[model samples]
Target: MTLSSSLLNAFAPTGTLRASINLGNPVLARRTDSAEPGGVSVDLARELASRLGVPVSFTSFERAAESVAAVTNEDADIGFFAIDPLRGAGIAFSAAYVLIEGCYLVRDASPVTRNEDVDREGNRIMVGTGSAYDLFLTREIKKAQIVRTALSEKVVDAFLRENIEVAAGVRQQLEADAARTSGLRLLDGRFMVIQQAMGMPKARGDEAAQYLREFVEDVKRSGFVADALARYGIEGASVAPATPV
Candidate 1:
């Protein structure tokens, strides 16, 4: 795609595309052994910068909310996030480029055996503050009380620390935590599917947003997203399907 000068400026006013890299979502981004940002989202950011003929700079955040804040406040030009209406108020999101499962984890001996048993009156669920699942469960879980930790990576630890009945987050994260900690197991099915997408500040306008949307669609169709997932050995996440014409 030939980007207009205006669109290019919209994406990289500082001559570099400042991409907000959220290390919170392991499926989308993570810290490499060198401690630099590296993952599918990082790859996408580099590709977008290359297509725009601009250098890319990464602004790392340990939490999704911080990443969203950077983009919404225009501190960064672009970010990867879960598609949620609350976040959409300040940002224009493309159709999802990846899909991740949101699951619940509990002690093996706990009574919460099924996904349906999580919202009981007495159950308290742990989640990452300001995460996609946090927003989702906040809206959907009417009965259970939500207890939040500072970050998604801390959800399992806090769940154990606070003695919460359930812990909720990305399926892979929960699975990893379960494997590391004895007596914990994920529920059989998922509660929600997180739509991971690229977004820019809403003030960037429709043309800029349309360009990003098309860029995401093109990458997904070309297998760039799938290849990146494989290259990183990321599992339990799938490339989002093409948007309908």
Candidate 2:
């Protein structure tokens, strides 16, 4: 019923799954002294913890770099974010819990309608630095000026100020930004598809990791996963039923 001494010493449970995580500042995670619950990332984390019968603790940082570092340093047991192979080399992952499409946020009056248009002439795209979208743009996209912003929120802000012609990020983040601000539109076209999962330390010997994976798989097996996305008003995220054990 309790974690062994070795396990306890490695990752002291805060009664539930102790996680040091952050949603991307503006969209996925937000921190405020206000009464609001901030974002869906925190909401999902708590839900997963409650189901797992563990208390969830968070070390909310302002950036992914900080969150990743915190997890690596054992300040947090897990990080809820997109999985990167480079980072995955050092972190373990539950099965991908969600898949999201990256999209374009263009000015309402812009002539740009597709990826082809950006390369033809004067156009600028704003992206979050170190984000998967940015990595893809730098690799597959050419001919446009790519400006790297600090985060999804910053990219949204820059586009709002007309500093960049377009912003690229997850649809949820962009649409959420648009919901709060005017004159921004999420273009109908998708730039990329991204898969998000829970992250833990790289050590494979940890029994808790298996529990984490099983817990995630169970969440998918149950109706809970899709319901959480629905509660967040996320339309595209759907979990397929689990296969036979």
Candidate 3:
């Protein structure tokens, strides 16, 4: 059959995009209207979808690692993860979107109050499995015997129940749960910069790579990323332009 000019036009890409957010960040999560995506990552994802003239959809996941898997599995066109090279195996990353300092978790009654405190004590530090924080703990943290566990929520639970001395993870992750345990406190100490960004499956190489770079660049140039981060009380996170300084 001969192709008509109108037929070719209808088949053209509409710049439509699809994405998902990791809902583990309580600051960005809303329980009342759970269907709506309102957090930092969700805001950025929705903005990009709008800019691309696509209908945006929202979904939630229990962990960041699972969110990354959604992308590779094609459940989502894109998903965000804290920057980890190992996580990059099945997907591609844009420039980092935000960086948050990580710290240690201690009981309210524990004497451990600083980074050095964890080091001075016997093994107690535990981190989420396949997390950038875990990589940092292994390479840079000393003094605490680092343990990796899946289901970070459970990790915290185990720490509290199993008589573990200390646990370290993302700042937001701990802050969101501090109230539930009654006596848990996030010890004050800078462990590492947790940089996060969206990842796309490597199968869409050329198109995905271009889209990510442009998305990061556009957000930075417009000050949109900075505004979004600040709106969510995520200070110290800057939107660096893709251009060389």
Candidate 1 stretches greater than 4 Å from native: none
Candidate 1 lDDT by residue in tens digits, 20-43: 999989888889777568999999
* Tens digits of lDDT, candidate 3, 50-110: 6555676766776677788888776677777777777778877787766677777888888
Best by TM-score: 1
Return whichever of 1 and 2 wins on lDDT. Answer: 1
lDDT of 2 by residue, 57-169 (tens): 66776556667777776667777767666557677877776777888888778887775576544777888776767767778776788887676557788766666888888
The deviation in Å at residue 64 for candidate 3 is 1.2
* Candidate 3 segments whose C-alpha is farther than 4 A from its true place: 1-16, 27-34, 108-113, 117-121, 139-143, 153-155, 179-184, 235-245
Cα lDDT of candidate 2 equals 0.69
TM-score of each: 0.98, 0.79, 0.78
lDDT for 83 (candidate 3): 73
Clashing pairs in 2: 15-55, 16-54, 16-55, 23-29
Scanning candidate 2 in windows of ten residues, the lowest lDDT window is: 236-245
TM-score of 1: 0.98
